[model samples]
Target: MTIETDRLRDLVAAELGRARDRTTLLTESVDEGDLIRQHSPLMSPLVWDLAHVGNQEELWLVRDVGGREPVRRDIDELYDAFKHPRRDRPQLPLLGPGEARRYVATVRDKALDVLSRSRLDGTPLVDQGFAFGMIVQHEQQHDETMLATHQLRTGAPVLEAPPPPAPAVPVTGEALIPAGPFTMGTSTEPWALDNERPAHQVIVPAFHIDRALVTNGQYAAFIDDGGYDDPRWWSEAGWAHRQSAGLVAPQHWSRDGDGWASTSFGRTQRIVADEPVVHVCFHEAAAYAAWAGKRLPTEAEWEKAARLDPATGRSRRFPWGDDPPAAEHANLGQRHLRPAPAGAYPMGVSPWGVHQLIGDVWEWTSTDFHGYPGFAPFPYREYSEVFFGPEYKVLRGGSFGTDRSACRGTFRNWDYPIRRQIFSGFRCARDA
Candidate 1:
């Protein structure tokens, strides 16, 4: 193998090893049987998740690559996510702690050896990229599951840690962006999800997309104005959503008159008026937009406004010219696990003046979540396939808890209007 290939292989191997190490360390905090019992229904058992992740890697990277099937044929039948019977995973020989960890260690060693000598050049790297991607994702997911599992097992939230002192707010002014035919979606790059395919032209007439997400104080204004009680501020769907859930405000918002408080790291702290409102739902955002005489941007318009390149109409992994999100810029998971003041990342701005497009909070758009033309499922059968119609609307950008890689330009996410749990919220755009 070439030096570049060798180096890449080694790096990939190391990444997997790091996941192994993290999971190992996390296990020390709780008893294994108790962990499995607590989070069983919400998360797969540790042994099951571990074996399945590795078995999936081998199946996709080896057997599907026009290479020989695994020495154990049943491994695919046993561990493949597509193959595994959903919502019925507990009956299997889910691994115990020591055994499950050992299984992960063994399969990883085998995968490294196979990859080091495999001849998969010119073959689509989707299997290779997504396999490694999902494995890392799965392990990291396991870490979260274990934590939540511990809570489910223990009946209390585990991440009850407090945040450090707040950074003083910056005084800033409105940024004006003159809009035009801003082309939307990915115009460059080969690897992207099905929702981002058929990279086509979109015409966005001039409009004012907010320079930042709606802030705590701004949302408070809506609440103070009786936005919920007034019918003029809500669509039929939005009104029904509000009435069904008995939701009157953003999930973490609290006001005691003299001051405000917002939830952070699973605890409440003094509210910063300028902080963008995170942890809201599509329904809540729609109502707020209606009240403001603005509407959510179409997914096309949101993508166009958020796109960074002029020459290629390329998608960006982040806004502000694709330098991965930084602490000073956005309030992503790596940060306080909470909202950040909007406009925190000036250099991270898009081609237009849209801020917080990458992280901070996922912004809900008016567009319904649907697949592009000629879309097909890859490894996971029901990923983008299940929600490919108008039943759900599109959401752009990402939230504080979002996986950074999952927020790439052209990436699409959808949820029923009622799912306010994912830390999603929105900004509005006025028709020009």
Candidate 2:
């Protein structure tokens, strides 16, 4: 291996280790009952996630990349995510915590061995350690999902993190993004998934976007104004969904006397008025935007705000620059269980002065989830190709629970319009 290859190998191993550590932190504090219990029909059992992480690693790294026999072929079907729905996972014969830990540890040992001797070039899977990066990212994604499970579990607080730093100054009003064509996606980002592929030019008209995400105080105004009750502000579908679900405010939030409070990861606390509103679905975000006489930015507009630099006319890797996220730059990587106060992370602001565009909450965009022109799926179609359509809305940026490896300026997240289990929020956009 060359110097570059050696460095890549180390980075891949380190990321895998970090992901595993996060998974352990999320699951180890709970008893076996918690691990096996499915918190919601939308989410798998914690133990299923644990073993699925190992099963995916074994399939991709040990079986496919190394061309080795399957270590535990009998369990392969049991852990196939596509074959089994999350609702049925608890009934399956999932590996217990002890067995799951041992199994994954064994898989990791072999995967590292494969990494040690395997060439990091040729083919898309092996080229530039793509397979290794994929596995690391996959585990990190599942770690985020497991964290969500922890939040949905009805029990005492198991996860803990200090609150994020308060904003230095309050950010008010909006940023006017200049109208023109800017690169929307990435062709150079190594670990970028298929949906964010084939960087292309996107021409957006002049627009005004919120300087920061909508704060709890701001969202409170909407709730106080009866934003949910006013059907004029909601799309027909959104209104129907809201009515059926009986949603009055953001999920996990409740009216506490004269104020609002929220529960997260089994811990209940008063809502921080200055922090960005979270646990909101796309419908809620859209309705808030509509009530405020604004609209959700399109996926292209969101990307341009986060990536384009007007002076140089170039797309940056992040809002700040090509440098990776740091504690001072953005609130991410499970560093804080909740979002920082809006207007925080001035260091992470985009060239247009859009604050907290990279992290805090996954910002909802108006566009539906779809592929760019000339899109092609690599390795498998299930990852991105199959999910494209109107059913899912695009969400830009990452949340507090998102790992840096799984997030980027061009990274895309999607979910149903009414889903609010994830840490989702939005910044409004309007015509300039």
Candidate 3:
């Protein structure tokens, strides 16, 4: 179901407030020169990401079609996130930081009005709901990017203050859901993204999924048991990927005493075994599942189980009910700058009694990342076609470093098997 106008407006205001807090904190005590520096190969200059805080919201919700134009002509010349990925973003206009901030403020004003006044739920001004969803998700995404820029450029308060002394509670539960004639894609609803659409039907049989993600401890078991060395566990592609990565364990993990642990933000901590595994690629997930006699569920099966309508609620835009993410829901976001323990978000659980499905990490599906039967590539043809070769795999649900608005139960993303970073992770499933 779609969120109503008033509620959507309220959400917009709240998101703007959060964004302002982060932006203000990030920009304080910073030289203008540093804001323009590209911090990492994966990131953009702070100025571009800052402008996008307004650019993305306006692109779809205001300037594109949702509202009357706020800025004058040639907006794209000033801010177009699609023109380049963050790493190569063009410098912000030559205006002083104050004037630039004012320009950004105008864009936000336009977005606020559009989101507040537009009739979006049923007959959206734009034909596809994604146009709006993209804006929301983009803002949420910038919240994280803003934080990352602050951390990389300057040692900002990236971590939560009075941070919990204890680490995440390890996840440990498993559920074997009995599957049937389950709908595999979006339900009959107005405004679903095309990638999630043309609602189709599929049958999934009984299967078991870990109650939470495979934790650092569990993966450590795989390592102690020679999980990484055993080529038999790896898919042909997985083996090649691991060799290329030169990985013996998760990217950030380290051995602490007899057990394994991981570090983030320069803090060394013990690993939690009950949590789902993170920083793994499709190759590693596949290998681990094979070793454990489990398998990565197909997108259909994973979605089916997640759509299970237990007492908590119905199949929502997320495994949780139809609300945007919160810090308590999952280890999402820059709220904590690291993954919360898996299974921590029972409130966000799907009908299947799964935990942390929404936030901790994006789970890999067995299926290749392909278009649906009636899939039509809109907006840009190259987006879905250029990556259609045999190299990529589909990942569903959102990951920790993800934009909340861009993500949905049905949003699709993919990566080559060899890449690993803070954002990727996996869950395990098996045939019943």
- The superposed Cα distance between candidate 3 and the true structure at residue 319, in angstroms, equals 3.7
Tens-digit lDDT track for model 2 on 1-432?
599989988998899899989988887979999998998999999999999999999999999999888889999999998899989989898899999999999999999999998999989889888888889889989998988888888978888899899887678889999889999888888888889989999899999999989999999999999898999999999999999999999989988999888998777788888899999999999999999999999999999999998889999999999999999999999999999997779899999988999889999999999999878998799999899999999998999989999999999999999889998999999998
Spell out the clash pairs found in candidate 1: 320-348
Full-model lDDT for every candidate: 0.63, 0.91, 0.66
Pairs clashing in candidate 2? none
| lDDT-based ranking | 2, 3, 1
Summarize candidate 1's per-residue lDDT along 1-432 as a digit string, tens digits: 577666656766776676666566546555656535535454555556656655665665555532654645555566655655535666765556676566566666677666666653455443344455555555654554443334334332334333322434343433333455544455343345556666666566666677678888888888888998887878787788788878888775677676567655345577778777866788788888888777777787677767646656555555666665666555554344456676566656776667777776778888887766556565565657877777887887766555454456677778777766556778888866
The residue-level lDDT of candidate 2 at 333 comes to 95
* C-alpha TM-score for every candidate: 0.79, 0.99, 0.79
RMSD in Å for model 3: 4.4
Pick the TM-score winner.
2
Error of 3 at 240 (Å): 2.0
Stretches of model 3 off by over 4 angstroms after superposition: 1-11, 16-34, 66-100, 114-132, 145-157, 161-173, 187-191, 255-259, 310-329, 376-390, 400-407
lDDT of 1 at 2: 70
RMSD of each: 4.3, 0.9, 4.4
Instruction: Compose the digit string of candidate 3's lDDT tens values, residues 59-165.
Output: 66676655575564555655665566655564445344565578678877776666666655444344334455555555655655665555444343334433312
Clashes of each: 1, 0, 11
Q: Which of 2 and 3 is the better model by lDDT? A: 2
Candidate 2 lDDT trough over 10 residues, lowest sum: 264-273
The stretch of ten residues in a row with the least summed lDDT in candidate 1 is 156-165
